[model samples]
Target: MIRFENVSVTYDGAAEATVQGVDFEVPEGELVLLVGPSGVGKSTVLGAVSGLVPHFTGGTLRGRVTVAGRDTRTHKPRELADVVGTVGQDPLSHFVTDTVEDELAYGMESLGLAPDVMRRRVEETLDLLGLADLRDRPISTLSGGQQQRVAIGSVLTPHPRVLVLDEPTSALDPAAAEEVLAVLQRLVHDLGTTVLMAEHRLERVVQYADQVALLPSPGAAPVLGTPADIMAVSPVYPPVVDLGRLAGWAPLPLTVRDARRRAGDLRERLGGQDGTPEVSVVTTAPPQPEAPPTSRLRLRRKARSAPTTAPPAEVHALAVRRERVQALRHVDLTVAPGETIALMGRNGAGKSTLLSALVGLVEPAAGSVRVGGAVPHRTAPPELVRRVGLVPQEPRDLLYADTVAAECAAADRDAGAAPGTCRALVTELLPGVTDDIHPRDLSEGQRLALALAVVLAARPPLLLLDEPTRGLDYAAKARLVAVLRGLAAQGHAIVLATHDVELAAELVHRVVLLADGEVIADGPTADVVVASPSFAPQVTKILAPQKWLTVAQVREALA
Candidate 1:
């Protein structure tokens, strides 16, 4: 069990405590989900359980945090390694070994377990997390989802009584996320392990939480209750909860099956209605008039009333090979101007590769890739920016400046824009970001926002984003939806490679499903998602046989 008694954490040279008056306890064999907006102290609270807050992070702890009756204030992280295991947001940083089997055993070896015990636990963990086939695979070569599972399995091998996970499923696809959640469920029910997890994608894990802890804002006291109790009033929630609230369900349903059981009357009411949701008009202040526009900027046609049209970016017989791995195999795809497309697939299913090819990050071994009539691989960097812009999976890879302000300034200089142009975009996408804060010190979501702002400064005809909403909360996600939607309206083609099905349903007009380095399915959003149970949104599942994909759509139809 984990307990926090009047815990408050303040970093060095801070105005006030980042987390204050937080009191909660996770009973043995239970999973507690920590929910809050971006920049809230969710990660700070999770770090306290394993003594990473004041011990390694160089912060002052006001009260006590105990795990399995071991006071973290008195004990260091290594001292409590036997009973506590922690995994941070970035899985790559957690690995101390090259291969999966070695990584799983590293923690046990550090704990000084006998070789026999370590070997048995390694085998057991590989099987438990369904990583037996990939035990010898190198960690760097694994997909994002696979790396996540490996990171978790490395900690699970220690068999700790308390597990602390920060955004455990952020990088995983829907099915893989379900597998990870199912493993946690088994641990709670069968092994009596206590789990404390913080995640931004609430729709994927809210149903699995034994209890929900809501952290409304920074330095605010947390509210603890059942999932329905917290979601009824929580600002950050899934579409199903909103739909439940709209329909006045007595108790908010956490799962699709539960919502569907109570949706019969609502379904009949919306039987023969058809209407599009009234999208809010997102406005931005006028750009600084001093900036000069770059050349080769072609005016694009507006969005077509029909779906069939020649795409701005196209891939024909695309085959990519890297280090003996065939990432893409004879793949063909296209993205039309003024259209938003969702790229969905399992981890390592060529989603990132496709995005990379579009932006010229990866060279294809065979076939051709064209973005606005220019071959991305052969296009020069300066010229490519006018044609396409990419926000890669690792946001830090694109960031090198010391401070946020310097990064934005560099974006303006490189894009030939006005001095304050990049900063304005950052304000629209991510508000309240301090100009002096070091880019390394910001949270995962904040770093992603900064990187996105840098990419958007170029105003390329085609924009490609891979896992753009990894750590963004609902409010940040809504702002991103508005920004990206605005870009699409301006005749820019957008392609997002993500696992968040709700985002795909709410924003994109088309869905392209890939598997094993090939395009398996491509069609309209409703047609593709309604047929795939794992990728379907909660509202669509509840309103089945009615062809609705979001709560906004349902509300629009009813109105």
Candidate 2:
């Protein structure tokens, strides 16, 4: 029901079109997934469907885009609201009301639907998305994942024929992401709703797509095919696909069940004589003395040995209360220098709150938090900068400067580092970001890189990141993994709260699982994740009864 005929879009600013010669069509009642690396104009394609391209974003539309027989060029977003629903990358920008229930109903009200119909749809969406309990909660008070659900629910209540979504599950936990994807499936299968979604987390959404559209690189025309076909040749793919390619399977598998079915022989090849897969061991030495402070942050690969220094961060029976909710309770943890930990759980499991407590963003109701041997909440900002730094879930929270250049300069000043130190980090992490561009104009992934660079400039002994890979693609994520691994080798303690299980599988040395504000599972990465059904990566699931955590491990073993 959506068609793009020779579509090309160029913003008002400078050079060429962001997307060129893009032509595709979505059959009625089908879900099409748009896949590509970061900064490939996937968002631009999605925006075009909902009439946000040139209409609201001030770009030039070279070709025609029609949805359900309505031309987006002639029909502005407001005029096409009846038939199209759009959800952008950031959920906070979508809300127009205070409470969850109100936000869900706002779209229906805008369409002038009858009060009874609106109420019915609102209740249905709330139940579908599992937001019934959060109906009365303020949007600002909800967690990032919760806000994302509300944003999706708001668009869904209108019952639009065509849905355009950008990273619908980026902020959601695994189970929550499944629920959202299932909802989209039902909408397409049972109700004849058409969906066009662009997402970086292909592991969560690729298998569910009816067809796939791949934008190979920046300003490249899209190529369309079946999920399996596209994944076979696409530069970006999930772990299961990587495993399939490694094992030389005839057809690549998209789902765990399919991969598991084809994994019998491969499993035998990698299995030990006892019929169990050989376990991979990761060891770190006891803490050593603290290293001398450096002039500026630099990426260097040191030996993967833990230092014998004192722990950089210590949390003892930490209890944190936000408003009336006890966000965290009786949590005790320690991070030795040159160690990396992944804090993971479902939404509102207190992972973010725990990070906040470490950074002194939230005060503990009971117990204590220490970073670099100093009480976090009691330390001054200037002193704290040298001890700990946090890149929050909302990367924009740490960004305040008008331009990229100004932000880097400010980071250097705040961190007491050499000039251009932060700029160098930004260049390494996210290349091609000009100094003149505003932080607000950067893509979600670009903004995140800048925020991380700003924090890394200080070279704090303890580093904390929340959902670090939210918008990063595979290449960018690889760069991040390398950079973080280098930091850990340099005696920096890194703890990241994330829902990206693949990231946990590939980067972290340890996995700490939290639930209901309490630590439930804490151990080595392979030990913790391989044991959990919900948290296991695709490779682990496919090669079950085996201890494999990543495709790279499997590749190394086979080689």
Candidate 3:
């Protein structure tokens, strides 16, 4: 069991506490979800449980934090290794050996377990995670979802009583995220391993969690309860739950499958199954949102800018090498200047790898990459930085400034952008909290805004974002869409790699589905997402399973 009593943490070179005076418990075998906007101290909480907070992050933590009856402060990671297994947002953080088998065996080996014990555990994990086929594969070659599975496999081999994961699926596609979530569910349900996770994509995990601990927006306390208890109050509840509220269900449905059973009744009661869908739960067909528009920034494309470069937009196939992993597979791809393209695939599908390759942060193993007729590798680092701005899945990784204003200033300066222009842009992206003391201190949603604000400061012609809504609440996601719509309107080519089908459906002109370093489907967003039949489903796409991505689009169709 893991416990936190009035625990709060602050890091070095950081201004504020990530979590404050939060009391919680994770009994053996129970799955607990820690969710809030980005940087709500969720990650910090996980880190504390695993002894990474003070040991690795060098933070000043107050109150008591214990794991399995052991004081975390008294035990370092090495000491807690056998008792608890941990995985971070970035799977690359813990990878040691190159092969999947070696990775799985790494932990057991460290503990000096017998070869037989290690072998049996490794084999069990391989089968459990559905990684038996990839056991011989190189760690560098696995997709993000695959790598994350391997990470879990490696830890599970140790048979730790408790497991903590920090946004493990942030970089995965919806299907891939589903795959990982399924594995996690099995671990918690079948194996009786206690699971504590911090995730931004609550739609996928909320139902699976036995307990949901919601950290209020910055300056507030965390509210703890069952998933149903949190759904009604959480700004991050999925559409079905929102619809459940509209349908007047006493308690909201937690999972899509459960919601579907009663959904038909609500629809029938509202009107009929034949003519335009009924509206018992919500007033409109698409179910207009109760969230205030002010919580989000909604902007439609004003006009498409005509670029000097004519048709036959450049196709650059670049290579990327991150540490030991050659992330990009030297794949061929092209982007039309005015078109919005989405990079899709399972996690570690190399979507981010490919994007980084285009920017030259990821050195390619082979093939050439060019952006706007300029070779990315040959271009100056600063020039490449300005050519493309990437909003990584982990917002905190991108933020490091005294205030929101200062962060924006640094981005502008780095991009050689005009002074104060970046600050002006922050107003819309940040909205009400633009003037906040420290962007870091805001709620998870606000922090994401600040991070995206900095990335936009570069004002790059090509925008590359990785899961832009990783930790956002409902309001924050709408605001992000507005920002992207505004950028696309200006003819800024945007390529966002995400698992957010709803955001993609509304913002992307086209969706490029990738699997195993290959483009399996590439075309209009509606065609790609709605066309899938065998693949696992996403919430936004599930309820309607239509071509539309937003409530507005559904309403338009009904009208």
Top candidate by lDDT: 2
Candidate lDDT (C-alpha), each: 0.84, 0.86, 0.68
**Model 2: per-residue Cα lDDT over 340-383, one tens digit each:** 99999999899999988887778999998987777867866655
Q: Model 2, poorest ten-residue lDDT window?
A: 295-304
Stretches > 4 Å off in candidate 1:
272-311
Cα displacement (angstroms), candidate 2, residue 120, comes to: 1.7
lDDT of 2 at 259: 90
Residue 149, model 2: lDDT of 93
Write candidate 1's Cα lDDT for 486-517 as tens digits: 88887778899999999988898788999989
Over the stretch 41-98, how does candidate 3's per-residue lDDT look in tens digits?
6777888999988898787989989998999889998999999999876677789999
TM-score of 3: 0.79
Which numbered prediction scores highest in TM-score against the true structure? 2
Which candidate, 1 or 2, would have the higher lDDT against the true structure? 2
lDDT of 1 at 273: 36
Candidate 3, residue 62: the lDDT equals 90
